[model samples]
Target: MTYTARSIVWIVIYLLFILLPLFALLAGSLPPARDFWTEFSAALGYSGLAIMGLQFGLTARFRYVTEPWGEDVIYHFHRRISLFAVA
Candidate 1:
């Protein structure tokens, strides 16, 4: 595949991997929270946790994933994104 096509494919896969847990939550039985804040907080917590976990893989120097963006760019993002999780 050409460079553009390969990049697109990796982007899609990355998106899918990061969002897969959220998509599963939609299918599974949700928590019994009637108030919007409670549900919203739960969703936010889940999303943050998912992305935080995936950062490890992104920084692990995987050739296939890092190839699309370059290793330095991938590690740079991992550092920045991890800070949000810390806060």
Candidate 2:
């Protein structure tokens, strides 16, 4: 695939990776629904954790993964996303 196509595919994969936990939570049995803020907070926490976990892959420098974006772009994303995850 071309670089743009590959990048788009990777973007989709990244989104799926980050949302996997949220999908699992919805799929599994759970307690009664809580207030808006409580559920929102929980979702945010899960997203943050997923982003933090993805940091490792970002830094691993896998050529197939980095070829589309390049090392600099990947590291830049890693740094920015790390800050976002922390917040």
How far residue 36's Cα lies from its native spot in candidate 2, in Å, is: 1.5
Off by over 4 Å in 1: none
- Cα lDDT of all candidates, in order? 0.81, 0.93
RMSD of each: 1.8, 0.9
- Over 1-87, each residue of candidate 1 has an lDDT whose tens digit, in order, gives 878999899778867876777788889986675898877777778878877888888888889888877988888888888988667
lDDT of 2 by residue, 1-87 (tens): 888899999999999999999999899888586898998899999989999999999899899889998999999999999999997
Q: Provide the TM-score for each candidate, comma-separated.
A: 0.80, 0.95
Q: Least lDDT summed over 10 consecutive residues: which range in candidate 1? A: 13-22
